[model samples]
Each structure stands twice: as structure tokens, then as C-alpha cells.
Target: MVSGLLWPIIKKTGPLLMLLGLAAGGYWLNRHYREILTPDIALGERLYQQGVDGGGHALQGVTQNDIAFDDAQFNCAQCHRRSGFGSSEGGNYVLPVTGTILFKPRTFERADLFNKLFKESQGQVFRARMRSAYQRPAYSDESLARAIREGVDPSGRQLSPLMPRYRLNDTDMAALIAYLHQLSIRNDPGVDEQTVYLATVVGPNVDSADKTAMLATMREFVEWLNLETQGNLDHPNFSPGYRSDFAKAFRLWRHEVWELPADPRQWPTELASRYRRQPVFAFIGGMVNGDWTPIHDFCEASRIPCLFPFTDLPPTGHTNRYSMYFNQGLILEAKAMGRFLRAQKDPETRTVVNIHSGEPRSSQPAKTLTQSLHGDKRYLVVDLTFESIEQLRDQWQKLARQQSAPIQAVIWPGTFDKTIAAELPLLARYAERLLLPSPALEANQTRFPADIAGKLYFSYPYELPTAYHPHAFRVRAWMNTRDLAIENQRLQFNTYYALNLLQFGLEHVVDHFSRDYLLEYIENEAENQLNPGTFPRLSLGPGQRFASKGAYIVQLVNNDQRQIHPVGDWIIP
Candidate 1:
């Protein structure tokens, strides 16, 4: 009777008890796994790149002397950079916070001696040799939180006051740390132990001779670089001092030419196929005849750097991060022309006739010039579009018949040749002043007549031919030594400048091999006297994609001597 009574109770309570136990265990496991494996990486990326949090609010921080800052103005990407490889700026070293660097124990070695010296110099390195090496344990999650929140390192040492202490809750902090843990952990796609691969995109519209010149210059530079790198590695004398430390950064450079298809629509597919076959670290010294929007889109999508392509047309109206141009190309020239016209004191120059071949390259600038002169009541802007050279001649004749005042004529011939050169003299007869695009004069400098040259005002983007630039001589000397013909000075010099810039940027990087890091260095060091005199000046800063910022409205002076002079100071509009 007693056993039977106890059996009923046991059966009823035992199953309920087991069920409750299982529920508790499951809950605990879920929480543990969620904390370890399910951080919001997308949220972390937002906070890192845009300085916005999960709630879409700007993140806040405090720097030296408790100066408050928001992510809108100063985000992590601005300093540590998108790749998490920190940069050295104005003697202050921003330490790398990537998982590759943070998750491992930090030990001081002879290779890092220079970095340590600069980092710990406190604005002066008078006795840097006397400083001792530093070591710290790998960061635990809690320590990382403290480091971010309190500006402290894993070794319990205070970080530099320049480093900002961010205000983040546990969840946001966890997400950010998660992102950092995986940032730049693997080597970039195009690099290996011994060689780094690069590519240059040659558009379908580029001339055969221009393409040949660009490719030859790039190949010669690569060959010379590889030879120098090999020599340094093989020589016993290079193994002794700081040179050996930097020798680790040296790698043989191998490059490929990515030629796009004829159709613009197929360019993306062609580029994708090429990239799929083999990825490249960057695109350098590219040349394209038409719009560069397709290549720009491809580069931005793939997170690759497109540096200094030779073109008169670049993508418009979009903010870019990976592509850097020498200038705004045709757009810059057009805006400069508008500003030049508006500043004129002559009241007789009232009507401005903007004529183009209706091609995208010419029409876009024609439209841009109209927009720049939109509200200025001093001048009336008129747009004339033509289909061909024959149509352009007809349109010019029509304008000449209707012309009344001493008007100014701006011609944007999409393509320049002997036919276009022949029309310049006729166009000059109708207008008091004639302005031609840069390419018009560049292609037919020797073909213009003496009478037409006086009225000609070319939208010149580079340094005037009359100006003395010492760097030009140096560039020519280098080309001469290499046995390269000087057929296109602007194209060849710009190519040579691009190669030199790549070499400088790579030297500064010293084996980090992050595309973002390379770009950051280029932006910071672009104006350090590296200009090869193609432009008046070449410089870039944070978020500045164009290196040369201004242009001149130059007048052709002597037709026989082929000399041109700027009418005024360089205009930056």
C-alpha cells in the first residue's frame, strides 16, 4: 500500500522536474552562445565607418583635455582607418586595432624600433635611443572594453591623450570589438609572400599609340622595381642595419593590363571576369577616352584603388573613396571658363554661345558651363548641340548670321582633328573672343593660323608652356635615359608621376599591404614636391579625390613659336 502511494507521486512530479531542468539549461546555453558568436557586425561597421550606432545616432567621444567630439566629425575610420591599420600623423602614431594586432601578445622587436621611437617620443626624440622596449599581454574582452572606454591599454598603461575615449554601452562595445577582431585578419587578395600583383585598365576607346605608351611606361617601371628589389635581397651588404628591417617590405611587382570591351554596358562584365580570374591590389596609370563611371563603379564596389587615370571626363555627382583623379577633367575646365567669363569687366561681352558635338564628354561640360552661368544676369548663356563636324559648321554659320554684339563663343568639340582645327579660324571670325577646350589646342597646336590665335582662349588645365618648371627637365631626363620617345609629354609625364607616387606610398606602407592604408598615405603625402609638372600643383587631403585643383584661361600668343600665356592668375572655381 505505501509503495503504490509513493509511485503515483513520483510519476507526477518527476517529469515536471525534468522539464524545468531542461528549460533552465537551454536558456543558459543560448545566452552564452549569443554573447560569444552573435555580435552585430553590420552595426559595428556602421559605427566604425559612419560613426553611427545601432539606433542610428552619432557616437560620442572625448579626446585630450576632455574635448567632446561626435562621430560625425571624427570617426574611427578617420584615424585607425577602414583597414584598422593605424597611421602616423604629425609625429603622433595611431596604433593598429585590428584583430591581427590586438588579439596577439605585443612584443617589441628590432624591426619595430623606429615605430616605437616615434610613438613614444612625446613630440621630441632627443633621447629615443635610451628608451626601453615595451611589451603587453594580449587583450581579453574585458580589457578591450576598458581600453576603448577609459583610454587604457591591456598593460594597465594610459593611452596617449590624443586617443579619444568613446562612450559605448555593453552591446555596442561588444559589436565594435567583434568587428575589430576580424578586421584585416587575412592578407589582401593580390599579395603573396614574394610578389604583389597590380593592374591597369585600358578602356576600349583609348588610342592604340596612347595605350602602348602607358603600358610600356608601367612595364618598364615594374621591371626596374623588381630588379632593384631582387638586388637588395641578394646583396649581403643590405642585411646589416635598418635596411634589413625594411627589406621585408620588398616584393617583386607583377602587373596585368585589363582591357575593357567596346560597349560601355559590357565593361562591368569584362572587368568582373578579369577580376575573378585574378585580383589586383590597385589600378594605376589607367587611360580611358570616354566616361570613367563604369570603371569607377567597379573599383568602388570591389574596394580597389583607382589612381590617376588620364582622361578628360570623370564620373560626376557621386562621392568617391577609392578613385583619385588628377583633376576634375573637362568639368573643371568648364567651371573655370564660366568663372573667367563672369569676372570680365567688358560689358560688350554679353552673350555666351556654348557649342558642343552633343557627345557625352562635350555635352556634359556644355551643360555644366550653362549651370555655372545660370543666375548671372550679366551674361546670357546659349547651348548649341551638333551631331558632327558638318553640323557644327552649319550651326556656327547660323550663329554668325544671328550674331549682333561682340559675343564670346565656347566650343567643346568632343573629338579634335584636322577638321575641327580648320573650323577654329571661322568660329573666331564671328565671335569677339573664342574659347576652346584643352584638347582642341593640344591636338592641333601647330595647325592654327596667326590671325585666329589672338582671339583663341584655351581652357588650359596644366602649367602654361611659357612657365619654367624645373621638374619637367628631370622627368624628360629620366625618359631619355630609358630610351622612351617623348611623343605625348602630358601622358608620359603623368604616367611617370603615377609610378613615382606608387613607389613612395609603398615605401611608407612598408609591408602592411592594406589598400586603405596606401590611399591614406597617398592623400597625406601627395603635395610633398612629387609633382612632375603636368599640372600647376598636385595635392590631396582627407576626402579630396582631385589632386590638381585649378585651371587657367590661357591665350595663344605666338602661332609660329607655339607659345601660350595665361590671361590671369589660376582660377580655382
Candidate 2:
């Protein structure tokens, strides 16, 4: 049995004599299973975090002033963090204890080290900046142990008052040292010297034109990037002065299209099948009309990053870790409308009716709006299932005539056709009460009667069209150059923005293709500079999913036939 295992190991690594004779043999084993060397490393890790000892007792530490701190009061990770790359809170800077930082034969200024660590955190907010003039020397095992136990640095200087001196026995100290030696030493998956594989999911029901436009946008961008970096595509070292020095060689981007089924239950299996073929580094620029929960759950389960898909409803709350959205489409509109309703002087005295055609895509917003305004009085839902436009008009007329109290708002969450727009004149009695989502109004813009223009208020998630004209012109010019049609402007624009954001983020990440690192780079760097797109502004922070946080409640200004302007300041809801 021993011979069989040794035979394979010898065959893969080298001859038996070479394995036995070379110093690299030990290095190879250490690199392969560095964390598995001893149980002490795992125990030390737990102890560092929970202050638990080898005997399952809480480990305590003492401050320089001789004040005792229990496990709850003092944990190593609280200051040093899990990877031993320290933290900053307020003006206090913690020292790094990772083996690479400690044993290296160099010194780093406090500001330089903190800058490296800040980038490591991927631009997370709330972490304070380093402001001290302190410097640290390379450390040996004895000096590191002294720093932990006696509050003295390798340079014989006293540590900061914030650092607690631990009362660790020799064995525990050795274990802790061993654990620190292996921290942040392993390489994550989905990256290599040759290529970085990426994927985008397309829901089966996504419109063919939108699908074509989104895929084209991504493919064209990837093609352009590869062409620009062709010099380093297969070279051992990337050219100097590139955006990221971390990437030594140009890693070609390979794209995969994972087309998901309409039935959400089948999405898991489909995704698994595609992933099994070849795992991707991340997912970007997907399009879906209905719920994105299935994709969101898959990304979370697999710990893969899914960024900026063209969908309105995304998973809400702060719990999701892997999926990011442009905005909470219809859900955002509902919230904005709710804020408007709440501000009305006598909203309780007026009836608020949400009108939809009973389709989930249309009704979902109404449902969400009703849920948001659940506690408020005089809120009602009207589901319209008419086969003809005349029937819709007759019903609207009847509702218009039957209203005893004033209708504060008559919300239409679904897209409106010309027939509906033509019938708007008959319901002019409730004209000023009309409220529609931006998409619905955009769809019916040409058909809407001039009389209803001033009376209608729209929930605009992006900058007004005039404000976005410059970006629109640029996008069109680029598309014209590529011989691509300006079909599905919304999808094309969002797709283009997503690709730009991805490229900007990838440049910052350099060669670090870990999914979490990709997200961190975007969260830190893209907020203030996401431009040449349609949104007024796009931003992300820790626990934030939506890039665009606020919406404009605008009414037609009447200066021109189709001109619209914001009624008030942007509202974040």
C-alpha cells in the first residue's frame, strides 16, 4: 500500500531519489497542505478568535496597565482580523502579524502598510485611515511572541496601549505562531496564468432582441480588452506601467453563456450542469423579467459573484453576499410612491388605487406598493383583466365617475399601450391623480394626450433623458462604429455600463480574480466614477445591493411637447 501511494507521488513530482534528495520536496508538501501540518494550527486559530485554550478554557490577556480582559473583552481577530492583516478603528492602527509580513526582511511605514490593508478590505466603509508616524521592523519568532506577551516590539519599543498582552504558555504561543505562519497563504480558484473565465446567465423568457444586445455588449468589450492587451496575452510578464502591476501576464477573458429556463425550479439544475462543465470566475450583465431570487440563491450558495444584471426586483435586506443589482426596479418605484403618499397633507382622506393587468410582472409592483402602504388607510388594489381597450376605458370611466372621495393617486404599474393612452382623455376627471412608472410612460409617450402630460407624475429611477443625452449620444456613436443597431436602448445602455464597471473594477483588482475581491474592488472604486451611463449616480457600500439608491419624481414641464422635469429633490426610499 505504501509503495502504491509513493509510486504515484514519485511519478508526479519526480523520481524517488530526487524526492528524497531535494530540499524542494519539503517545500512542495508544505505548499500543498500547509494548513494540515498540525491540529495546533486549527486550535490556535480558534483560540485567537474566541480566546479558547487547548483545554477548552477562555484565554485571558492583560493590558500594559495591568487591567485584565476576558475572551469577550479581548479577541485577537478584533484588532488583527482573520488573515492576521490587522485593522484600523478611529485613529488606532493595528499591526500585521501574518507570517509574510512578520518574517520578511524589510520594514514598512505605518501609512504604507495601512494603505495595503485598506485595499485588501476592498474599500469597505467605516474602517478608519492610518495617521500615525510609527514604523515596524521585521520580526523573528521570539520577538513576535514577546510583542504578544510583553507588549514590546521587535525594536524594543513598547506597543500601543490598545494592544493587550496575552498570558500564553510556550505551547500555546508556538501554536499561535504556527497558525499565523499559514494565514492568507492559499490561492483561491477561478484564476490561472493563462486565462480568467467569466459567465453571464440569460433567462429563457428574456426577449430575443434584449438578449442579443446584452450578449453583444459583453462580447465586444471582452474582444476589445483582449486586443488592447494582446502584447502580454501569453507572455510571462505583463508590460510595465499597466493599470495593475499585480498581473504579471495578460490573462485572456473567456466568456460562457448560461441560458436558464423560464421555470425557476429548473434553474438550479441548469446552473449546476453549466458550472460542472467549467466553473466561471463571475457572472455579469444577465437579463431577466421576473423574480431573480433563484439566481441570487445560486450565487450565494456557490459563493460566486453575480453583478449588475438587468432586472428590477432583486433580493432585499442586507443578508445577500454575492449578488448586486442596478436598482430595485418596480420595488424602488413602489417605495418612492409610498414616500410621496406619506408626504401628502390629507392622504388618509383620499383613496389610493393600484391598477394592474393581473400579470405577475405587472401586479408585483402593485402588491409591493400595497404592502408598503399597508398601515395607511384608504388604499385599494384593482386588478384589470380586460381583453379589449374599450372595456378598460369603460371600467376606468366608471371608476372615475363612481369616486365619492378624491383619488389622491391612480397608479398604473404596468406598461401602457396606445389604446390605453388614447382613452386617457375620457378619464380626465382624475387626470391630476395619475401616477405611472417611468417605463409605462416611456412606452406610451407618443400616444399620451397633451392634456395629460402636465397632470402625470412619473417615478424616474435614472437621470432625466435630457441629462442622459450626452451618454446616449456617446453610446450611439460607439454602437454605430460597431455596426450594431441602437435596438433596445435601455438594455444596451445598462449592458454597456455593466461592462465598463466590470473593466474598471478588473483593472483595480489587477490579477486577483477571487470573486469576493472583485466585488470589493467595485464597492470601493466604482461609486463616484461610474459614468458614461444613464443613471444620475451609482454607488455601493458594505451591505448595499442597489447601485442607484434614489429616484426622481418628475412631471412634464410643458416647455416642449415631451419635456419632463423633477418636481422636487431626489428621494431615497
Candidate 3:
């Protein structure tokens, strides 16, 4: 009786156990297949971006007309872009290769069709001219491989001749396909269905007025953007016969302020904590008195864009992809000074003195100039550090007494006050030329001593005041209408420009809402006309982090009038 009872129970459980065994075996087989097919994604990234294979060799491709090209000349990023979202240029539309766009079946809904037609015709095209929606099946791995090597789509249609045929081996092709499958598949943080969030960074020890101006301008712009978006949504003007597709792109803007700690060491912790609580899509119109390295590093590590911070001391070295600056800051000014001194036709033997207060803002440029002219036999570089105006005066007197050759002095007092301004004219008598950064003179233009106007020169990184910038009037009118005070023009104008640039970049991405896509748009489509007359021209391109590339060495002319005039053309060093 016991054996019979056990036998019945075993019969009931035998089928369940067999089914579980099959399921486990199936899962193992699937995983094994995935492991076999999936190659290293980094190799694929290099192939897509740098056009290099896993073996450190340049990948090769062929055009439809049998023209061969190497990776250096024809990389995927050159056309499809770093985001893999593709772009339209020179009358050709490059199809997006991101996994989100590629792996799914291709079919346009009625709204999407209308939007495309409306965009292409600028809202003038009629429905009678509409064509049937094109359709294609979802791409399988084998189909995608064929498409890459043979220029054929999953629907057996030949791709455009502009699409090059790559000669990727089995392993390399799998890696490239895997990379494409992973490209921009998920939405970045700080974006939702109806709103996108952004932040502005404020570093420690910044002037209260400047900080206020930057924040006010950005906040006002965000408020205006939300109001406009609401208006568009309320009056979408969508009809059965004619649809307003542009209304779909409207999203409310949410702005946040991130104030960094006074201690630089705690910046990363603070930034990470704030980001964890509430992430932002990008940073716009930041202001700091000192170096921007800490903030820049945070942005880079987080893969967030930091746009156009106001500072005279940006980090030096290789160009950073995530951080875009207005210019190279004091480094540019120092290089310009070096170029000016080298171009001078004065006596071969000369003494160049670089004096500062040992602060990064002051000492960094001095160091840059000294390093730039290190091996030159034409002149001798003397670096001097002073803590007070009295100490600087004593050093100046001692230098004047011992100087044998003509003296060219570049002084950065670190803090430009009335006391320093008063002492600059007296110190200028001892040097053939006394150089200063434009920011120093601009900060104290009202109390600037006219006696030093003749001997003093400035490294100017902006358009001369005499040139007409009609856009400045627009900026002023916008500020006046908003009831915002113009305490700091440079700060306010740059802040306004950064906001406008973010707005422009967002407009291009529409519903995509990818940080990489936004950055790519900024790199390629930043308009010069958007500049608010703070700089001569503001623009950017791929791999370019600095918008302004040159500076002018200027002199304060017409001492009675107190006008700043350029000594020569702009110098790009």
C-alpha cells in the first residue's frame, strides 16, 4: 500500500520536473548563443567613432561608384554623427542608426506623416500631394548584417548610394551591429513627457551682484519659455484637414540652481548628492570667480553638458566634450600677449616682467607667458609675485633701477581696486609697455587713470566697443521688459545667450529628448546671430569647446574721451 501511494505521487510530479528541466536548458542555450554572438562593444564604438577595427587597423569602405575610402576619411560619425541620430546636410537625409530607430519596424502614423510633410513644405504643402506611407519589417541580426555589408534594407530595397558599404569581417561586423543596437536606446535623466529640467551652477565666493544677474536672467528665460509652451499647447490649431505638428514639440521648462560649496574638495560630493536627488539635463550660464575645473570634471564624469560658464580661468589641456566655454579665459589673454611681444620690432635684447598676486586668476597667465617664451633668446622673462600695492611699487622701482634693456611688463594685480588703479600709472613709467587683461580695465572703467592710457595695453577677447551690435539693443529691451536690472552686462548677456542656445538646441531634438542629441545639435547648429554682442561672434562645431578663438590687443586711446581702440587686428594664438 505504501509503495502504490508513492508511485502515484511520483507520476504526478514527473511531467512538471521534465518541463522545468527543458525550460532551464532553453535558458542556458539562449545565454550561450548571446555570448557567442556579442563581441566587445568598445571595439564597435571605436569602429563607429574612430573608424578603427579591434586589431588597431583602420576600417575600409566603398561607395556605390566603386570609390574606396579609409576610416580616417569616411567614418560613420562624419555623417551619422556621434549620437547616431543622423543628420540632413547638402540635400541628403542621413537615416538615424540608433537602436531605438533601427530595430523597430518602419511605419509612419498619420500624425507623423503630417508632421513630416508640414516640416518639409513649411506648412504650405497640401494633403493631395501626400504619398502612401513607406513600410519595412523589423531588422533581424542577419538582415542588419546584410544591410551593413550589401547596402540593402530588410525590405529588399537598395539603400541610397550615399550609404557606404563597409568591409567588416564577421567579428567586427557583429561588434558594430551590437554597438548600433545599444546606441541611445534609453531616455536620459531630467526629462519627462511634458517637461525638461535644467540647472545653473554657481561657484563659491562669486560676487553677489553677478550671481544674482545670471540667475535672474536664466529664471526669467525659463519662465518665458513655459508661458510660450502653454500658449502653444492651448492653441494647437490641429484640424483633420490640416494638422499643426509643431505643437507636439512643446514642453514646459523647469530650472534649478546648484550652488557649489566654498571648499573645492567637497564639490564632487555636493554635485553628486544634488544630482541624485534631482538630475538635470544640462548646465547653463554658470558663473565662478576662480577655476572651473571641478565643475567641468563633474559634468564630464556625469555625461552632462555644461554650456557657456562665465569665468576668466577655464581649465587647460585637451578639449572637453561635455563642457563648452565662451573662450579659453586668461590662458587666451596670456597667449595673445606672448604673440604681441614676439611681433614687436623693438631691440633684440629686452626684459619681460610678469607680475601677479600669486592667485590662479593672476598667476596662471603669468605662468603661461613664461612657459610660452621659455626657449627664446630674444628676451628674458622675469616673474614677480606681490601681495600688496606697496610691495609691487618697491619691486617696480628695484626692477627699473637694474634694467639694462627695454622693459615690457604684464601686471595682473589679482584684485583690481582703486588703489591698484592709482598705482598702475606710476608703475607704467618704468616699462616700455604695461599689459593688462581687458576684464581688469572693464571692471573699473569709471575710475581708470588716464595717465597710464598711452603705455598700457589690453588683451581684448570681445568685439571693440566702436563696432555696431544691433543685437545688444534687443537684449536690453528684453531685460527692460522683464524688469530685470542690468548690474553686470557681460554676465547678463552671456546668461541670456546660454539660455537661447539651450532653447534652440531643444527645438531641434523635438520629442527625442536625448542629452547626446542636444549636445550634437549645439556643436553643429549653434548660430552666430544668437550672440548678444558680448563676444565678436559665438559659434561651435564638432570637437570644439571654445566659441571664440581669437583676442585683440587693444589700447585705451583719447585719454580725454576714455575710448578703447584696437592696436591691431585680432590675434589668434
Task: Judging by TM-score against the true structure, name the best candidate.
Answer: 1
Error of 3 at 236 (Å): 2.8
> What are the clash counts of all predictions, listed in order?
0, 2, 0
**lDDT score for candidate 2 against the true structure:** 0.70
Clashing pairs for predicted structure model 2, backbone only: 238-248, 312-329
Comparing candidate 1 with candidate 2, which one achieves the higher TM-score? 1
Instruction: Residues 1-573, candidate 2: write the lDDT tens digits.
Output: 568868777677776568576668788787778655454887778777677877777777887578887664376765676446564445455666666667775454433343345544433332333433456677888998998898898778887777898888887888888787776554345567777788999887666877887888777878878876665554435444432344443567888888887688999999988888788878887877677888889888988889889876677743587888888888888888878777667744566656666655567777777777777765554444444566667777677677676764545545343345666566556635777787766666464666666667888888776774455677677778878776777777878877777776665545434465567556655564445557888788745678888788888776346678888778897
Model 2: residues with Cα > 4 Å off, grouped in runs: 1-184, 233-249, 346-348, 357-359, 374-402, 410-432, 468-485, 488-490, 557-562
What candidate 3 gets wrong by more than 4 Å, as runs, is 1-36, 107-136, 238-243, 374-376, 416-419, 558-562
TM-score of each: 0.90, 0.72, 0.87
Looking at model 3, the pairs that clash are none
| CA displacement after TM-score superposition, residue 72 of candidate 3 (Å) | 4.5
Cα-lDDT of candidate 3: 0.81
Alpha-carbon error at 357 in model 2, in Å?
A: 5.0
In order, the Cα lDDT scores of the candidates are 0.82, 0.70, 0.81
